[model samples]
Target: MTRPRRRVKLARIVNERKRKAALKRRKKALIKSLNTICVLCGAEACMVICDRTNNQGTHNKMVWPSKEQAEAMMSRFKSLPQEQREKKAVSNEMFLQSLLAKKSKKLESLRAKNNQMEMEEILHNFAIDPTSIEPATGKLTRLFLYINDLIAKIEENESMSQSATNVNLV
Candidate 1:
């Protein structure tokens, strides 16, 4: 059998100001309920309602380990053999270094892609327009100035790269 559609309760407040105030109060209560921490565990284990109901609904919070329990577990781990601890530390360091290197590579690739897109946009704007050569007034003058600046920058970059390559060879 097909399930019947659930009906939602309409707000009793008809006035605009009163309805807004009611909404604000309900929002504050919901936020407070969600931020509530459990007494048994130190974790924020408050349950949130996903239904269409206006009520905050039931709390089905999960009980996690308290701070004392976590500290005890850590102490047990620290009491392991010196060689094992060293191996664990070394592996953690290597893992962290590899993660950092991977992130750096991704950032470098994004930067290169951004630079290439900007260069292509500049080339498209400057090279595709033939009107800049016909006049020496207003927009044409500005375009010619921008193109000259871009040419100077390209020459400077080429010289810098050539110098760097020569230094690397030495």
Candidate 2:
């Protein structure tokens, strides 16, 4: 007899399969609806941002090199037993090297993004003295307004004292 957990798992699997089928059907319909002809090869294709050899009838570009092509290549390499499969091995090695370089570039970009984000946080949060006409926000602006009010009060007292002195002199 199936346990309670097993029943739950089966229900989840059924739901997931339905979801996958719906998604697949949607994709197929969209592809079918693609009305554009491929410019590069003049084939009926579904790609939107079509660029030459990336010309595609579908989202996946590099259709496998074909069994016949592989067999031909194998036969050529077989004829040169001494030459071995050095070319194929070298090509594979280069492919991995390029992949490694791409990964390195992506990592560098992420690190730069993080560094710039931290710098932005510092710029926004830094405290500036509020006496100047420069733009301010949040607590900084409030502090500036408070200081300006104090300065205005002091000026009013100074002007009143000067007028009193003038009146005494007269």
Per-model lDDT: 0.64, 0.57
Residue lDDT tens for model 1, 8-60: 46757778687768666766666565456444455434233332233466543
Model 1: lDDT of residue 127: 83
In order, what is each prediction's RMSD in angstroms? 14.6, 20.8
TM-score of 1: 0.27
Task: Write the residue-wise lDDT of candidate 2 on 1-170 in tens digits.
Answer: 97563322323334766756755675555554543333445643323322124245435332113446546656776788665646546577798999999999999999977855654454455535224334553544554555576689999999999999999999
lDDT of 1 at 105: 100
| Every model's TM-score | 0.27, 0.28
- The clash count for each model shown is 0, 0
Worst 10 residues of 2 by lDDT: 45-54
